[model samples]
Target: MSKVVINSYEEFERLLGQQIGVSDWLEVTQERINQFADATLDHQWIHVDVERAKTESPFKSTIVHGYLTLSLLPYFWNQIIEVNNLKMMVNYGMDKMRFGQAVLSGQRIRMTAELHSLVNLRGTAKAEIKFFIEIEGQKKKALEGIATFLYYFC
Candidate 1:
């Protein structure tokens, strides 16, 4: 899908309550899970120890950490939209964030986002986007929540 470009607050305001865009599928490999584990110092067997997880874990495989999945929000959001003419953008915060399903290693996940609300605070733009991370071939979502971002258009 082509990216939705927002050059100004007015353009962003137009997309309120609409599905903005979808990101390409990203695979959660054991290597990625291990890298995240190393980066965060979280070496739980359910996330890193593949050999043990296969036998001990009910999932029969290593699962991606909840934080690891949540951390990819910005990455996926970038794929969904490109806000040009910005001096800078700040991650305002996230609200109503929920983790619904576990992402097993090797499963592909993609995100769908909607522009839930848009408000202009003087010159700054506050965009509240509702996003859902879905695992390929799974009916349940891996994660879902509202992410707020502040855009400073130049």
Candidate 2:
């Protein structure tokens, strides 16, 4: 596929609602979950206590932190498509966010990003994108939400 260069406001607007590629699966390992738990100071039993979780938790194993799922957006976004020739791009904010399903540790997940909306912010272009994070080999989606970003051209 061709890379989209946001040269002008009109060019950015033209790409709205475009279909981006889905990312490859990223494994949610127990160590990664623990590290994230430690970093975030959210040392909950459901995410960190694997032994206890196996007996008490319905998942029968440790689960990935919700923020971990959210944090994967950048990695997933890179896999979708390339937005070239920009001085910088910044994450503006989320218009909407939803965790459709919990991600269990040891599961693999990927994202499908669709361009949702676009607007001109002063001279920069802002894009609102919706990302659906699918859990591998499962019907449940781990996460789905809209994220906004501001792209400034050089």
Candidate 3:
């Protein structure tokens, strides 16, 4: 998939309130979930134990951790947009984050983002993007939130 390139802060400002783009679908595999669990030291049975999850978990399968899914924001965002002429970029923060559904392992998910707000703070650009992480073929979104980014345009 092609990325939407924003050459300048002005161009990004013009796209305010519009959906920038949707990222390509990414599969949430068991391996990824296991790695994430190991990295974060969150060895929950519901996430790593396949057999136990199948027998006891409500989801019927090992599900991806909510934080693991949230952590994909940067990777997914890069797939959707590329900001040019930037000296650096920082993950400012997130707000109103909601996990609406569990992402089962092996499910495909993609992110759709809209420009919620943008402002110029000196030479830096503060961008707030409202994002929805959707599970393939599901009616409910896996997660939704506003992700803030600080761009230092050179």
Candidate 4:
């Protein structure tokens, strides 16, 4: 898919309340989940133990870390849009975060993003993007939230 390029605040502002773009599907492999578990020091059985999880967990498989999926926002967002003329960009914050479903290991996920709001903070642009992380073949979203970002355009 082609990225939605935003060279200025004006360009971004025009797309408010509309879906910016959807990202390509990314697989949630057990190896990735284990890596995330190692990085975060959260080696929960539900997330890292495959055989144990299959026997005990209702999902019957290892699940992806919620934070891991959340942290993937930047990767997915980059696929959806390209922001140019930028001196820098900052991850501001997240709001209204909700985990609607547990994404199992081996499940493919993709992100759908919309420009929820945008404001010019002096010379910087503050943007709020509404995002949904969808699990392949699932009706329920893996996650949903509004992500805020600060765009510094030169």
What's each prediction's TM-score? 0.98, 0.90, 0.98, 0.98
Error of 4 at 143 (Å): 0.3
Q: What are the root-mean-square deviations of the candidates from the true structure over C-alphas? A: 0.6, 1.9, 0.7, 0.6
Better of 1 and 4 by lDDT: 4
Candidate 1: clashing pairs of residues: none
Model 2, runs deviating above 4 Å? 1-11
Q: Quote the lDDT for 73 in model 3.
A: 93
> For model 3, which pairs clash?
none
Winner of 3 and 4 under lDDT: 3
- Cα lDDT of candidate 1 equals 0.94
Poorest lDDT segment (10 consecutive residues) of candidate 4: 1-10
lDDT score at residue 97, model 1, on the 0-100 scale: 92
Writing each residue's lDDT as its tens digit, candidate 1 over 27-48 gives 9999999999999999988999
For residue 91, model 2's alpha carbon misses the true position, in angstroms, by 0.8
Against the reference, the lDDT scores of all candidates come to 0.94, 0.84, 0.96, 0.96
Q: How many backbone clashes does candidate 1 have?
A: 0
The residue ranges of model 1 lying beyond 4 angstroms of the native Cα positions read none
Candidate 3 residue 99 Cα shift, in angstroms, is 0.3
